[model samples]
Target chain A: MAEPHLIYFADPMCSWCYGFSPVIAEIRRAYGRALPIKLILGGLRPGTTEPMSQKARDELAGHWTHVQEATGLPFNRAAIDGEGFLYDTDPGARAVVRVRREDPELALTYLGRLQAAFYGEGLDITRPEILADLAAEFGIDREAFLADLDSRDLKQETWGDYGTSQRAGVTGFPTLVAGPNQDGAYGVVTRGFAPGDQVLAVLNQWIEGAVAQH
Target chain B: MTAARRLPLLAALSLSALLAACATTPPPKPLSQGRGAWSFAPANRSESAKLAYGIPNSDDVGLMLLCAQPRVKIWMSQPAAAPPKKIALRSGKAHGVYPLAPEGEALLQATMPAADPVLDAFAASGELIADQTRLDARAANERAAIRAFRGACPAKTR
Candidate 1:
């Protein structure tokens, strides 16, 4: 028999995942340690090389507007407007992986901060220094986080999460999966963004269903 | 193996490999209430029809179809951008080709006229393919929904 837990497949650079941050927080507040939620970076745009075309950047800005309207999340659309910016998601994902190495408990909290910094504040998370600055806020040594974020091994490990997400059939961001109960079966909580209330209702039912198995 | 037998054996192995590749492709998430089905949003007084191929009222959808009669538009979610800017649609004998444009980070889009035979094939055919990715194909009642939507909205007001 395996313990019931949640796995969140998300990317810090994904706008929808940024929108879903509050809902994940609600889940944590409600369930606490009873339902441990694991975070996995979905690598939405890892290692992107091309400088975004103006049209592409405009499209991204439109998406941020839609996200803001739907989730009431603040977004700095100018983030995509910078000159010749490479929208690579690898470095941001590595920061979370490095933090997870230090303390599993800090992963989710740190992820939320990164989302807020990127979408909310328009900080360039693709840069190591930006990632290091965020880590310092959590009392994580800035120098160590940069070293780990820059290390090839950490990049490989962070990418491993992307592979896990693909193997698990997660095609969209903010995908939440729960389970491996006594029968070793799992169920999807939400494959995309859901209202916090709807997510809580599902979580409540999952808890009931798991308890019923007892 | 003799040459005749070797040729047949090779063909068999290649066919199996193609089938396996298609089978290994991940399934697209359903847009409406039921998996393996398309859900149509209520068509207002207008002649345009908007249908979603993923979850209802959610931003994370697999496909979205917007039809206003002789013209039909499709927005598909893609995992990555392809180099080519055209979408080739295939369903059995029916084939449709359209210019493909990226709508956003994960969405690729194409437009076609309603009079196009490919639209009919999409409504009746049990399978669909766009570019290299396989879309949700089924014989569920949602096929009727798609037909109704196509009927109510023809690219030009009928």
Candidate 2:
């Protein structure tokens, strides 16, 4: 029998996903391969150019506050002052795609760090220089990361994932789907930021049920 | 095999346009409450809706609509006494939700034509990291605002 797989559908730019990061890490540690993990990009706001409107910004800020209070995550408001522009996630996501291509391990590490920068430190991920600086801090080859930042390959990959997110009916970030692969597989799907314990329990129950089915 | 195959790429794409309540109509009635005092109205064309009963004790308020698409929710809010956010009803599960900011309203109304597509795309990606940042930033900002509010309003608003 094949070991069940865990597919995590998320975008690097999702707020709830950031809140769930620690929980996801814990799940990976516990279930390493009894259920392997797969990361899918949910593509939050793919190609936006205009800065966020004050109305939109204020509303969203309210959401951020609500989520933080619920999840106990640290958030920095001052970060907004730095960019003073509508934040975009594409650049940050592209960097992740590029890194994942060369080294999935490094990509995972970088993603965690990137999340911290955006959510914890409130650093803007939209700017190339900001992304490049982050890469340098990780001891990543700066020139290479910059080059790949706009690489056709990574762009295609990001688009591909965006397309995939669309197909899955995954309209939000922090969506989790577990089941048999596209080939009539069975798994689980946890859509947004629920408590991590709830997520783990759901996964555990799903795995147990699937095991019993066999 | 490349793990990318397992990434559900196509799924993300198809769902992108349907993510936001930015350009659509309001859902139906028979409302119920949601997270943090928010309420979800009946399902409409293809989604549900949420309305906050004013923020905590302040006149600031919010309204959200979630499409039948299941997870997609759009919200709009105003500071107790602002114009009901002027949003054009566009095709697709798109609906724009904004707070009552004079500056935000000007841009939202002025650039509606150009801004829609961009806003739609961002809503589509729904990247986890981006969500995290926005949520955290909002929280941080909110905490500060609340602190200031307490200092200013103390007994009444606090």
Candidate 3:
């Protein structure tokens, strides 16, 4: 039988994706290698050189508050409150693509760190240097990582993931899909944010059901 | 049948089985995660003489430990749910499964003696997960709430 796997479509800059982090972590904690999760970065808001308007910043902050209230994850509202702040998501997405080439699973872990750096710590994750520093924490070569981060090919590949998300018809951040079952059918695990235990239960049930079928 | 004829037939059967084993739909589409987080308010208020502790992001505690004198009711509020018949809880090394019932949209409840060791294990454990819900039981305010609920509620029965 073909081995089963997970495809997680997310944007590192999305607040609800940050909220969904703990749930994915719980899945990793509970299942480890028994199930493998592949990360596909959805380009939430890419290639914007224009600074956010006051109204846009206000609207984004409001969404962050809702995410925080729902998931108990931290949010530094002031992260983008400063004047002339740009919210380009390209760098963060490229960084994950870069690291994914070296250590596929580490890509997911690095994505989590980038989310924490962006949302929880209020770090400007839109910068290549900042993204490189986060990668270095995982023992990646800082200079090599930065060089790759600046490459045109990685930029195209990151955008490719966005295309994949669109083709998959994912209209939201934090869309998790399960399957390629024996019938090769895929199932939506959760389109939006869900708590850790709930996700863990669903995963456990999937395993149990597969075993029952045998 | 002759050995050569039988050999060819066996080989054909094996190849077909191998092909079936590797068979998959040429292209797989996304299956949606059909469920979202359940609603909480109704579950929070389901019990009479109810006292609750916060579980993050929710002002309403759908998962409750209700005070009913000598027994504490472990009520999980699940609206329009196909919940497990028993709640499997884990907080660190301490774990147990308690039976459950559906009172309405929310599952009715499962009660244990107030002094049940599992309750202490649940309280002392770092994080509490009841069935599919993870609970924040580590906060000081919540701990105080637990103590207060226990004090005001003497278990009506063991």
Candidate 4:
């Protein structure tokens, strides 16, 4: 039987992906060695400086409240509005790239933490100090992490990943791709925030089909 | 011809079983059901007492969200909820009714979007699905927006 690889493409700043974290983790633990899991960064809103309009901000705040109602995640809009922080996600994306170089395993964890810190706790992740604070919270060596943040290598890697995802035509965050192993490569694309059951159902169907082909 | 002949029958059965398994289609999932901790009272003065979240409007057909926590109640007046639409929750993003209606997912998709604490309080006091968090936040955001909108639409208020 050919094993299937499941790839989750997402951004750390994405709120929906953050909500899907526990469910995905549960699925991974449940499926354990039966399937291989891969994480890809789908860069959302890269290189944008214009601050969100008040109307847009209010709409987002309401949306956050609704999300909290559904998922039980915290959201303190005061913190979001207190500081004059532009919702620039570039710094946070750069940080994720930095962590990928040092500890590839923890890249997704960093993404989750950053999402929670910004969306949940309303921290301004764009600021370097705040990013360092988040890194410290995760017990990562701040000095090493900071050095990576400054590295040209990390910056290039972030841009490179962004370009690849764009070329792949990933329009949004939290896209999951699962397909058959084509001689060591799995190519399946599951898009958007689908229900856990839906995701599992899709995988199961694909697996059965693959077995028939074999 | 006794035991040796039985092997072919067993192999036939195995192949049939595998083919059946391959042909089995998955069962459709049930619709996701759970009340959002928030809902809203109707905006029409005649139906204002009726609590709702996504309600239709007669005019320019925009989106509106009307919700009530336990203590507070408000409506997203500028953009209103249209029919064939319901506010729903997904991982983090709030997709409009069109994307969610067919899927029947949660209406409030925030990370802990509802005011469960307040809901619990009401529940303890013998309230049925009185979402306190939804009510409080809904009221707060609504009041603030109305104040701002009123200022912006001063001529229309009277």
Residues A105-201, candidate 4, lDDT per residue (tens digit)?
A: 5776787888888877877787777888888877878888777775787777777776666565444456666533443344444444555666665
RMSD of each: 14.0, 15.2, 17.5, 15.5
Reference-based lDDT, residue B84, model 3? 61
Model 3 CAPRI rating: incorrect
Model 1 iRMS: 17.7
Please write out the lDDT profile of model 3 over residues B1-158, one tens digit for every residue.
54323333333333223323443422222233232222122123434444543323321234666666577677654321133667676666767787764332213367767666556665454356766556645446565555455445543343
- Which structure among the candidates has the greatest lDDT? 1
Best-to-worst lDDT order: 1, 3, 2, 4
Which ranges of candidate 4 are over 4 A from the true structure? A1-4, A183-189, A208-214, B1-158
TM for candidate 2 is 0.59
C-alpha TM-score for every candidate: 0.72, 0.59, 0.59, 0.54
DockQ for each of the predicted structures, in order?
0.05, 0.04, 0.04, 0.03
lDDT for each residue of candidate 2 in A98-160, tens digit (9 for 90 to 100): 777776656666777777788789788777777888878878788888988887878888878
Candidate 4 residue-wise lDDT, B23-57, digit = tens = 33222121221112223343454222223332111
Model 2: how far residue B133 lies from native, Å? 27
What is the alpha-carbon lDDT for the whole of candidate 3? Answer: 0.65
Q: Over all chains combined, what TM-score does candidate 4 have?
A: 0.54
